[model samples]
Target: MTATTTTLRVGTRGSALALAQSGQVADWLSSTVGVPAELVRVRTEGDVDRGPLATIGGTGVFVTGVRARLLSGEVDVVVHSLKDLPTAAADGIALAAVPRREDPADVLCARDGLTLAELPDGARVGTGSPRRAAQLRAARPDLDVRAVRGNVDTRLGMVADGTLDAVVLAAAGLARIGREDAVTERFTEDVMLPAPGQGALAVECRLADRHTGPYASALARLDDPVSRAEVRAERSLLGALEAGCSAPVGARAHSDGVRLTLTGLVIAPDGRRQVRGEISGRAADAALLGRRLAQRLFDDGAAALLGDLPLRAAAAAGGG
Candidate 1:
């Protein structure tokens, strides 16, 4: 379709964060690509079910419905929170772009501007990620960690209403929805590692249109090479481990002009055991770097921590 005759429909979940990000994508397409675009809200099972993510199929639950719409030609493009996307590629879909990523750190939103270290012992902390729960427990074993599910405001409300003393949330999610003021402290990577592709947005289109078309032109203009390389390395680690996004696994990657460095972490559900490894190589070797790091962590005892768990068996009942 020609740019003049086509109005691109960008698919996204209806959540506040999803809409906010999708709206940004739409605006970018209009301003940069000169292709007028509209947001198409897709209802996903993840948004409907209040059950724990692991119990309902983990990583892809939030993405499956939106993807179906894309495959069916109901939408010309789809924007997804990269971390929610599965490491396994879908057959006919192409990840056309990864825009510049947001901050991937986890943040602590406490009741009284309290930082993580200042929270009293036995204080109740809420989160919806197995990775966060495990890391938090490792950092503060005396605190009472609770599993939680809901939108950002709903989870933050737990702290406001005394249901939880603090809630750990993605820094990127808060930033996207203009809710960063709710954050009491931003956890450094030393304290908590983000999930693979966390803080990045994935722009997808049908494989057939990926190489040719106005959609392809828009996608090419939207993709950021740096962000693409970083996520490729991180997601590669997740894929190599064969762990769902909800698994108690964490990965982060950084690129220094000449080389890409990746770090992989695996923690036992109980937080009593852990393994971490790092690898660096040319950014062009991002995928291989991730696999190498994963193998290193496995040799260092991560395999035992992960082997006993089921594919989507998130030790903590949570959502992210």
Candidate 2:
């Protein structure tokens, strides 16, 4: 019997940060499975369009093309920032592993040195994320929140060049590419719980490939069980709320030995109404934690605030 020689194809975006992240996985594969590797770059619609993300839709816009490559056998595996993936898995697609998370908090970079507390009345704050925009508005109702969309450097440039007073971004992404010093202060969970799966990375492969199994298992070595449970709980909360990724929902889950605690927040667009909650349960019962928290919030009239928007517009926009 002859063994088939294999060099796994890893698909990723062409951006500097995307390549760096994919490189981390490829390096891990080579060391663990002793297999040669190659990177297949794909251009996502998100990359081609310099328009506002709101116009293009949110979440998965950066991932769909690479996911297609995975399904088509063009690439054996794909790398993604976990937040870019929806809580619901697509048909024929599954996530094999979620690596240990990076920092899961939004950061404020202010040129005027105004902290979230110090921003003057009617101050202009910039952010591409509805999650951040809503939360910032909820936190400081006095300031003016506006939309600004682009990659990290582009958004940061708004602050650097004095186009905006300050902007919010994921702390993990900044740290990933050596931009940590740009973070003025990391928002506390009460102020800005991160989006579901914000700081994690998901490496995916086809369901039953024997060769890729070894490499996938190698990547799974980096998975943090506690982070996995916490992120899973947070994703479940978002899913139950039926909130689009653009919805102003932020959450964090943590575990202490046998108990898992989930904290959730929902804020209105104008920053006037904010609802927050926390529930503790057995670490093994993530779904229960999410369900109970959502139910309690619903009893508190969360559903009244969440109107059923056109699902068609949402799906077309992106399952964000």
Candidate 3:
């Protein structure tokens, strides 16, 4: 396909990490597709609200506005952190691509370059994610886990200024913002499983533009099949469980061309109880494998554990 002369407008949130990620995509589109690409910053409710994510809304708050612009023909494309996207399908938007994934593990940004195990008893850890909080408390029952809100720099600043002993954040976000130096320890999957679809980017376009759009072919070229398959399994599990992105649930999946392995976990908010399960099958059965594993967890009492938590739709609508 020949490159078009028209400029493509990529919608994105104005946050530093969002800008960094979207800027990378725009550059790639310009260079690889020989088309001019510009970023259009779109403010989101998540950015404007200073309250807790749980109270304000869980997933989709950051994405809803950008998606609205895309649907309204205000932008040609939008980039999102895949983990922040809800498991439910959007009516008019198509996930055009999932580029190669980054390290999906959670990292600890701690004081004095201390690791998780090196922290002293009663050390305070800050995180806004229930998954991270539960994992931290599960691993270190003595540590003080506190809820924190803000951007990556703000959270890291707290640790640097001695307001908190440590904070947990996605390594991919730090790397995207060129702040990897803030990470003191990268937790392995065994120690800390990542949220579903973590470390992946979703490039979305209007469903009607898949074939006739000038940039459709270019965006399609960015899709990585292996990454797509892995995240599909992970998100499928989340969908089957009916949990939001911020739920106290963790999942990770890996595919080696032929076989796919998935690990799923549910941890109590208090970290007093936990359940985990793993399953492997043909890579072609990714979605089925995810659902089956979730069913296994449910059979092991995952439903009972999650029954009391706020549903994704309710949380996203600020009903929580």
Candidate 4:
């Protein structure tokens, strides 16, 4: 299809970060494929509800609306924050591309420039993610970990207004929103392993569109082999674990084009118990490496550690 014959409609959530990420993709599509691309803002249930994420649903909440639009032919393509996407595959849709990733580390956006360790006892740390909360408690048992939910600016506003001493957020989100300077410190991987597919964007299209659609060539240009391999390994681990976004699980994968290494962590919600493991293999065996590492973690008592959490069950059911 020629540029004048097709206008690629890219659907995205109507959030600042989502717009920023989708805008970048739209521009790339237009320039690279010589096709006119436009952004279609889709409001998700997650965006309308202000309750805790786990209570409303899990990560899939942000994706359902947009995916429906893609499947219904309202949009030709969609962009998603990789971390917000469930590990399970959706029928009728395909992940066509994963562009180069940004830094996947979680960062401390603390007031008064206080690092996690330097914060006073009982410091109020705001985060809605179970993984971040568990890590915070594990590192500083004295902290007052509070459940807070909002967009990036709203979360930052709490700290700016003295309602929260600090807030834990993805370094990638902050950087994408041009607020990286607000980060007090980017936590080391040992301190806080990032979520599966964090710091990446998932560009998806209808399964039927991947090979013969007008947007196929443009989407193909966005795929980064290294990022795709690394995120695939991490997400494969998550899928094997049968854990959802609400589970206190952390994973990060790295690839040097030839070899890939994946680290997986599962921590008790109360931060009392944790299991960690790592596996390395040829980059071509990324998915296998992730599954193997997950099995190792289960052998290390990850199942028992997570068995009692109702949130895990809720996430699984919601994803279905």
Model 1 residue 77 CA deviation (Å) reads 0.2
Candidate 3 per-residue lDDT over residues 1-320, each given as its tens digit: 78878888999999899999999999998887787889999998988987767666685788999999999999999999999898878889999999999999999999999999999999999999988999999999999999998889999999999999999999999999999998999999988999999999999999998777887888888988889889999988888888778888899999986899999998888888888999999889999999999999999999877877865556434322
lDDT agreement with native, every candidate: 0.88, 0.77, 0.89, 0.90
| TM-scores of the candidates in the order shown | 0.95, 0.90, 0.96, 0.97
What clash count goes with each model?
A: 0, 1, 0, 0
Q: Worst ten-residue run, lDDT, model 3?
A: 311-320
RMSD of each: 2.8, 2.8, 1.8, 1.3
Model 4: how far residue 55 lies from native, Å: 2.0
lDDT at 62, model 3: 86
Model 1 over residues 1-320: C-alpha lDDT tens digits? 24556787999999899999999988988776666789999999998988877778785789989999999999989999999988877889999999999999999999989998999999999988889999999999998999999999899999999999999999999999999999999998888999999999999999998998566876797898888999999988887777788888998999864689898899987777899888889999999899888888878987788787676333222222
lDDT for each residue of candidate 2 in 1-320, tens digit (9 for 90 to 100)? 12226886889998877888888887777666777789899999888986765556666688888999988989878999887876667766667767778888889987756688887788788987777887887788777788876778888888888788888888888888888888777899878888878888888887765235545566567666777788778878877887766667788888763789999877666667777889999888987798789787777777755553333246433476
Stretches > 4 Å off in candidate 2:
1-5, 50-55, 210-214, 308-318
Instruction: Sort all candidates by lDDT, best to worst.
Output: 4, 3, 1, 2
Scored by TM-score, the top model is 4
Worst 10 residues of 2 by lDDT: 308-317
